[model samples]
Target: MNVAHFEGAGAPPRKRPWTAPGALVVRALGNAAAAAPVEGAMLRFGRGRPGDPGKPVDVTVGVDDTKVSRQHGLLVHRSGWWHLSNTGRLPIEVGNHVLQPNGDAVPLRAGVTSALISTADRRHLVELCVNGSEGASPAPAFGLHTAPGHVWRLDERERLVLAVLGQEYLRNNPRAQPLARHQAAAQLAELRPGEDWDVRKMDRVVEAVRLRLSGQGVFGLVQSDLPQPIGNLLSHNLLTELAVTTSSLTSADLMRLEGAD
Candidate 1:
């Protein structure tokens, strides 16, 4: 008598190892609700399925969308920041930066950042949130004081331009986003009918502010610091820094714009 044995079913499937001290949380925004804490060095995202060739993505972004490639993009943890890299045919919108296929990875700031994948008919969004380590010390507030020289310096005209461009942020709006140049220009024209305020003038004023801040050791204010198709990245970064670190733009300034409207 003899016993029959299975040909190749001896061992269990190998489980993916979980890295200690999770660093990031990735959540897909849509009908498909998939959320996971990234405990490893990288988190892959795409429309891939299990048992596919090569390494499959960790998260399914556009499950039902045929346009989304199987291995669309990935988030890599490096140097205390999460960098997003797009490897799909279409571009991925991260904040104001559009990550083209095979482009350089863009480092995401702390807090929640929305990444969008757009198709002809619909849009897919993924939310990435980098968590600070438990018991970690608060970040130092360098040059974030109310002292005269410590705060960012802006002339009257420059302040007005930034006030208009960053009104939403100054209002503490949770959904605040940087305003377009045209919108800011139109608002400025209303605020100061005598002074000529067009897109070109607004561009110059903002550029001057950025140059000044960049000289002060502020990064991401210059074009070279950001990826191509910058969109509103400069404005977003500038406004966020101004809103949190300096009194260059305030609620009174926003009220001035509101009073005009």
Candidate 2:
């Protein structure tokens, strides 16, 4: 008796076969919650269909989402760091950095990093966690009076300006966003009417902080590191870093501004 056979045909595949014990873990957030380990040097992500035999991606991000390309992007382990590279038409937001399609790879710092993949209708979040590994450094410390050691010090004026700019986050606003330059300036003026505070001064002060932080290895502070129409990208990134990594800004800061004449 002769048995028909196919070259690649085999037993049913194991669930999340790509996953294994490794230093890097990539898990999709939300209902799908598909996860895989970066056992190899690289892992690809893209749109995946429910029951397609073909290997769409190592990790599935969106199903039947036209916006997500078949081979959207990848996570590559190189030089002891997992860097995210976007290969699709749309951009991928990883923490404060937005990785544009075909753009340069951005290193993912140690610990949990949130990456957002947006489709036509909704947004899909993928969490990339890099466990302790060689050459992997902890996220930078930019907090005042909170960090255990090695804090990114800010002058009095810089601290005040940042506090005003990040008041929304300090207030625990769910829809928090960095305040506009003019708005922040206005608040600072109200907070200290004697001192000169305007758009120009606000820009200078914020720029100084951004430059200092960027020089200290913080990502997403420089214009070239972000896309155009930056809007609040600089302030947003700075404030986010401050909000998460430090107690540099707090509700009391906001109360001070509000209570001011």
Candidate 3:
């Protein structure tokens, strides 16, 4: 069971496969009292029905329903165990995968659980053997590729957030040229909902970009709120000199002449 965010209300539906290579088959015991009925559906990765003669249940993951953030994939296992894996820059613990067994909903193992590991054997998924320019053969269960080209269009807020990333880049590298106007604008459009894209976050985010580019930059709101981890993510996301410069600055800063104190 892959946790995919589907825009079910006719919003460019992602193609669903009958079966995927790494898809996990899960068993749902019962509904959680705390859990509300949510939208978005789970599809098996490969090509067969989950013919477990238990519960014909559904598992879902998305912003509107599960509130699972930043995780690339989620699987509720056959033994009623849940596993969340990172698609981006974070990881979910094994304890975080526990289902609500017995009493009020509780995490699995109560913090004694192991880390989330792939159950797939070497056959289901194989690393590509790169043989010079000729490349290698495809693996048996090729999964949904989240390539950059697969990016859904960015909304206005997301674009602004992206712009903030650009601004951070510009603040540190004063000599760099500006970002492509259209590119910056498009990125701002793709903000995840309710993101403020505020100044303090923007400042450190900018500094984070600088640090990644030159291996050094600023952090924190006044050195106190300096978020080292988030800064690192920002750095990884914004590497180019142009992405660094414009993503770091605000409109107010932009109004001032470059190098003006």
Candidate 4:
């Protein structure tokens, strides 16, 4: 008996994510879904009731989402990445946390993305995507604060996760955006050894941390008001509420990361 094998049947290299310039995409994440601004230029989103006289914005939202203001949000391409800023009377959520009208900007990634913003009445689910991360890094924010009664701490992998989140991919780097699961897994894999962690466990890691924070009586997760992804909520809380920036892992934690303990 004989068997035939292809000489070049080896696994091909993983293809890198590439992006086109001046491209940003947005989609609705709620019951009724849609995309706006196309994905090529700067655009604005607004709403007009059935009888409102003003011209519709770049993306004319239907009267269904009354929460969307006349000029709800903006999509801008700056520095090296696409930025989403809320310019309406209400907050524009990019993920776990809502972006205040005058709040820090959140960088958009590629493909379909979901954000929850609200109006005087209800919340709206919207999505914005970019071609890819394209090496986009957020401005790093590192801080440590301790009071007589309140204190925050980070474990080993959490430190690494925050480090990846704080990476500066955008010029105006606002707050640290949570890393994608694969990105977090890759970054965590580099930081620690001996405990082979898989990307599959990223949610567990983040959720555990979230539950721990909840145990500490932290209400930051409620900011979104909607039960959503844990990682985004946790990252937003850590950066905005707890200020967990930089690699907070100390020598002891570093020992665990190096598996020298």
lDDT of every model, 2 decimals: 0.68, 0.66, 0.29, 0.49
| Tens-digit lDDT string for candidate 2 (1-261) | 011111121211233332232245555532222223333366666785333566445556775677887778777765545678998888997875678899888766556687888877788777665554332223335674583733567777887888888888888764568887788899889888999999899889888888988998887789876545566667887887777556666677678767767
What TM-score against the true fold does each predicted structure earn?
Answer: 0.50, 0.53, 0.19, 0.39
Cα lDDT tens digits for candidate 3, 45-98: 111112333322232222232223223233222233222323322222222121
Per-residue lDDT of candidate 4, residues 113-175 (tens digit) = 566666666766554545433422122235654534444577656655544443431112444
**Candidate 1 runs further than 4 Å off:** 1-74, 77-82, 85-106, 109-150
Candidate 4 regions with alpha-carbon error over 4 angstroms: 1-22, 29-40, 49-55, 133-261
**What global local distance difference test value does model 4 have?**
0.49
- Ten consecutive residues with minimal summed lDDT in candidate 3? 28-37
Q: Per TM-score, what order, best first?
A: 2, 1, 4, 3
- Provide the lowest-lDDT 10-residue window in model 4: 1-10
- TM-score, candidate number 4: 0.39
Q: Of the pair 2 and 3, which is ahead by lDDT?
A: 2
The TM-score, computed over Cα atoms with residue i paired to residue i, of candidate 1 is 0.50
Prediction-by-prediction clash tally:
0, 0, 41, 5
Task: Give the runs in model 2 whose Cα sits over 4 Å from its true position.
Answer: 1-57, 60-112, 116-125, 129-151, 227-229
Better of 1 and 4 by TM-score: 1
Cα RMSD (angstroms) for every candidate in the order listed: 11.9, 10.2, 18.8, 19.6
Clashing pairs in 4: 109-130, 110-130, 113-127, 137-168, 137-169
For candidate 1, list the clashing residue pairs, or say none.
none
Best by lDDT: 1
